[model samples]
Target chain A: VGPGDDAAVLSTGADEQLVVTTDVLIEGTHFPSGSRSDLIGYRAIAVNLSDIAAMGAEPRFLTVALTLDQIDDEWVKGFAKGIAFCASKYGVKIVGGNIARGALSLAVTAIGVVPTGQCLLRSTARIDDDIYVTGTIGAASAAVKDGVKVPPLELNELWSRRVDDMSCRYFMPLPRVQMGVALRGLASAAIDISDGLMADLGHLTRSSGVGAEIELDRVPVWKSMDAEIAIEASDDYELLFTAPAKEAERIAEMAVRIGTDITCIGKVTAGESVAVNGEVGRIDSPKGYRHF
Target chain B: VGPGDDAAVLSTGADEQLVVTTDVLIEGTHFPSGSRSDLIGYRAIAVNLSDIAAMGAEPRFLTVALTLDQIDDEWVKGFAKGIAFCASKYGVKIVGGNIARGALSLAVTAIGVVPTGQCLLRSTARIDDDIYVTGTIGAASAAVKDGVKVPPLELNELWSRRVDDMSCRYFMPLPRVQMGVALRGLASAAIDISDGLMADLGHLTRSSGVGAEIELDRVPVWKSMDAEIAIEASDDYELLFTAPAKEAERIAEMAVRIGTDITCIGKVTAGESVAVNGEVGRIDSPKGYRHF
Candidate 1:
């Protein structure tokens, strides 16, 4: 009976509380209409969860803002299924979501609470840290190119084997949940690869007040990707991380224990710059999703 | 530490939830750039609170999704101030929000959890119940013609005193929180004034699987407004509710106690149609806020 009361009282008893972040996925900009509803829903939650993962926090809940062209019942059903599948996979719950008509868009606000001071941020990288990335990169970029049949939006056979590749990476970038938790205290700084490797790494350096020298030769590339494609391809939902070189073996060990791959790509430098050793002519500029 | 983990978790604690509702506000359709940022923000939250009131739920925590054309810090700040004022006025907290670039729309998913089963909804109305409305209706519609002055986007007295009736209703609507809370157990079916009296009442009727015969003569009309303006006019944030005649009197008392005014609009009838007698025709043929 307190709908219009003076104030509202919310109950949340966690002391080390609230991992909050927002991400927007728009039509034409993020995904096209012909895209699978499952992929759309999966990525919607996955990207937001990546933000939570970057904080080294376990994502437990999500609030979805879905703006639609019209309530395509079948599409909504598939979208909901994708969201639920992701939630079930992560053990997260969709406590709330809004349904309204607008340009096809979805904005998700994810919240999680971790133990106090345990949350990781991009600002923790230090000079001389070994730069590493989880899983493969550039496959997503290549999938967008000619002759690359990116599994029919749905998880078909083509999508299964290379599910970890960049194209699938675009739809379902597995947030490094296991490695994130395992590398919590070990890794110096971490970020999910949404933008290009150079770009997201730049964020880590900028936030940590340091520069990085990424060794193009040391970068982990996939069998399908060539040298040039590896340099500029983006949407690799892997973790591009910086840790002390001394922890290189440990990082690899942790990745093994977590059942994921870790590859050393470069090292954190003392100065201010993200230099690609030989990739894409040393990406001196910031190439990422700019919200303007 | 599960960056790529399944999901992040936020605690809702042991408090009984109060209010929960989802409303999407679109750009170009809802408000223009010429509209004041303060009013936009205020109306955004206010309209949402109106939903909470309809459910007879307390206004508490809010989550905002700002899909922008460009990231305008000043515009956002002004918009936030407007919503912040409403939240502060009602003691609701701005828990979190997301910012992303889109075609320019905003969606707010607000939550207020009260004692379970105490919330009011449109499905609870019964026949022979009294119909009531909170505050004046159609002022917002007339403001379109009268050029309703609104509260200043910034601190300007000229805009403050010179009221734009239509704009105020369109921009800022008072969700009758106190009244809504008071009518909790008494009122049957309830809804906030968004689409217009006739239209919203239809939702309540349809939900309750009943019909209504609103007394056209009994409908509340502003002194400056005639029946013509009243029928089609929208954006009145008043609460239209149905209840037993005796309990309807209590709703009236609650409105008075809150220092606001309300009127007995109509009655719940048998069969599924909303009419305003011969003097007034059916309003809202297109309905409210149909986005493509």
Candidate 2:
């Protein structure tokens, strides 16, 4: 495993293999300056988990390195709570961490495990595979664009209630853990949509040496959201994957069993680019979320 | 296997155990703001490797997350070269990494393996165990204090040449990998001296629920470097450990086999603090490197 995939896989010489991924979130870049520290912490872990999930692994351990401008007790407390909450919910353990003085930033490294040879990769999608996406997209981007304020946390709130709030979606995009594990032997290739659907799909296609054709009308955008925004905006944390068309029914059953909506919005092609057909027009190049 | 130790050890059901450690280095805090990118990269990986070595494990895989102000092609290339250089020398692979735009910083997570039940730890030192350190100390601190310029790299430089160069010691502290592996069953407790000898000794004693008495004259300070500087300054990256007094000759023989100096500096005591004695005077508190 190397840089072209969602996470790196290491053979442990056991029945299982290890999958590792790292991601960094900086204040004033990934999130606005002075945003809630807890949310920032939650987002950092969540994003890294998304990468592990994309590899069809069960996240098991995490190590955090934080760079903060000062040692604010309240901020540190909130940040730790956020990390703990996410870790506990995902059956992950915070095994190690370090803190240093600098501009506010959090770097999280997640380690996960999958049965040997069962890990998913971006370069394994086959031609004529059915392209699928989980849940609705663009809500988080819309929340960012609209400046929504994150709501207060209720520990036992229903998932439906949490997903219905745009602020929650923006600040706490849930990693599709169960769905990803379910996808292990079913999906050919998978990627989490952190850099927008079209952009990430383009990554999968390019890596697999295949092309994709999206039926724009079938994309599961958040209610009443523009399809163009759904296609171009990032930070959705949904899964975009491909499988043979014959597996569509099995995938739909798995989605129902996991309580996640799965939509067959496109098909893998034999060419080298992603094509979007329907009202939103076509894009030849990927213009994903640019950090700079 | 937790925060108090240099690295976390995870049980792998197989004959080997996994050791993981993470560290972060920011531009101004860890190094000069405009220092050489390659040196910065090398220092980041070296420091993390020191943590793994302290655990008496074979350094294996690494994941890096970088935050840069801008995507300078030359700077990135240089940084990559530096990382590759250090990684290759240690037989470690860069398994995964992420880069983002922000204030320059690098967070590296190193994963290594040790045989079952043989990992070194800071909490296992027994009273009456002889304390020892590998290689000379304080050269890196002296180089930083004197503002020495790092010399250009020569791929096949001798270990003696690199250790003799103050600038090289400051910028590229060689992780005592082989020495650590050799100490697996011989040493009772071990830690790397990144935060000065006395300070790290304090850490080891505190974790082991013991005290330590150091004979300042026995410390292997670099050349004519002040003994005070050797005890107080940071960034040595030498292994400080404890072993049964009976193992002295074996440890000496191992040192010669590994071609690294081993100096017996002190002994573990029955109490809870550290006492340093010599011409420089005695200190009771840990004043290790502070990043703020």
Candidate 3:
């Protein structure tokens, strides 16, 4: 296992294999400066878990490396609470971590397990496979653009809140762990929409040596967000996958069983390019969040 | 497995257990702000590998999360080269990681394997156990204090160089992986000296509900540096462990076989405080590095 995929899969010489993924979120770069400490903690873990989910694994453990400008008691308390909440929600354990004094940043490594020989990969998608996405997109990106602040809540209340709220979805995007696991035997290839649908789909198709054609109007946009924004925006943490057309009905049933909306956005194609359809016209280049 | 020890051990349900450790190093905090990018990268991975070594485990995989102030191709290439060198040196694989734009910082997570029943821990030391340390201590600390600059060399040249130079020790301290593996069934408790000998020993004794008494003269200090500085300074990345008093000779023989110096530094005591003897006098309080 190496760096081309969302996470690396390590054979454990057992019935199960371990999938590991790491992500770094910096204050003023990944998040707004002075954002809620708890949300920052939650988002950091959520993003890494999304990578594990994309690999069709069940997240089991997390380790966090946090750097803070100053050691404020209340801030650390809230941050810890957020991390605890997120880990508990996903049935993941906090295995290990480190804290250092520096500019604010959070680095999280999430470990998950899947059955041996069943791990999903972006390089396995075949031409003519139907491309699908779970949950709605564009909410997080819109939240970033609009500077939406998630409402502060009592720590206990976070577990009971729904993820449909726009600001909540942005600040606390849940990783589609169940959906990814469900698609393990169904989807030919999969990736989480952290880098937008188009860019991530491009990644999947390119890795599989295939192409993709997605109808923008068919995408599940969050609320009334523009289809184009939903196509180009990132951080939705939804699963973008490819499966055979014959399995579309079963996937739709799995979606209903899991209580998530699964959308068949398009189909895989030959050649090495992603074609977008609908009112936004055709985009020749992939555009999404870039660190550089 | 959680955050108190150098690394967390996870039972793999097989004969082997997995040890995971994470450490974060920030520019201007863990190293000089303008330090060599390659050295910074090497030190970051080396420190985490040291934790795995302290756990008496064979390091197998590593993941790095790096944050840079800006995108500098040459700097990134050098840093990657450093990381590659360290990982390849220890027979470990670079599995996965992430990069983002921020103040320069590196967070590394290392995974290693050990027999399930033989994993060494700090909480298992006996009162009469003899305390031991691998190789020399305080060279890295002294080098840092003296503003020593490690000489830059060809990337290929790094592989063959011995880790005896003061500046080299500071910039690229080698983790005692072989020595640690050798100590697995022999040592009762262990920890890496990242936060200085006194501080890390305090952690081990406190965890074991025991104390320690050390004659400063017995410690294997680097060259002729003041033993006090060796006892109080941090970032040596040496293994400090305790074992049955009767095993002292056997450990010494093992050290010679492994081509590394292993010194009997002290003994575990019944009381819950560390006692220092020799020219430095008895110190009532444990003194070492504190991140906060």
lDDT against the true structure, per candidate, is: 0.69, 0.81, 0.79
Could you give the interface RMSD of each candidate, to one decimal?
Answer: 6.2, 8.8, 8.7
The CA lDDT at B277 in model 2 is 78
User: TM-score of the A chain in candidate 2?
Assistant: 0.91
The better-scoring model by lDDT among 2 and 3 is: 2
lDDT of 3 by residue, A1-292 (tens): 1121111223244677777777888988898998888888888888878888888888887888889989999999989988988899899888776778999998888888887757678788998999988888899898788886566676556535547667677668878999888987998888888878877877777678888888888999989988987887888988888999999899999999999888899989998778788885775544432221
Which runs in model 3 stand beyond 4 Å of their true positions? A1-13, A156-159, A280-292, B1-13, B156-162, B284-292
Rank all candidate structures by their lDDT, best first, as comma-separated numbers. Answer: 2, 3, 1
Per-residue C-alpha lDDT of model 2 across residues B182-275, encoded as one tens digit per residue? 9989999998988788778877887788989888899999999888778777998999999999999999999999899999999999987677
Chain B TM-score, one value per candidate, order as shown: 0.84, 0.90, 0.91
Flag regions of model 2 displaced more than 4 Å: A1-13, A153-160, A280-292, B1-13, B152-160, B280-292
In DockQ, how does model 1 score against the reference complex? 0.25
Consecutive 10-residue window with the lowest summed lDDT within model 1 chain B: B1-10
Candidate 2 docking DockQ: 0.35
Spell out the clash pairs found in candidate 2: none
For model 1, residues B1-292, the per-residue Cα lDDT tens digits are 2222222223344444434454567775666556667777877888888877777777767777677788888888888887787788779877667666778777675666555566677777888888888777777767656655664545233224323444556666667888877877888878887777776776778778787776666667765677655855677778888889877566667777778777777778877666566354653223332220
Candidates 1 and 2 compared: the better one by DockQ is 2
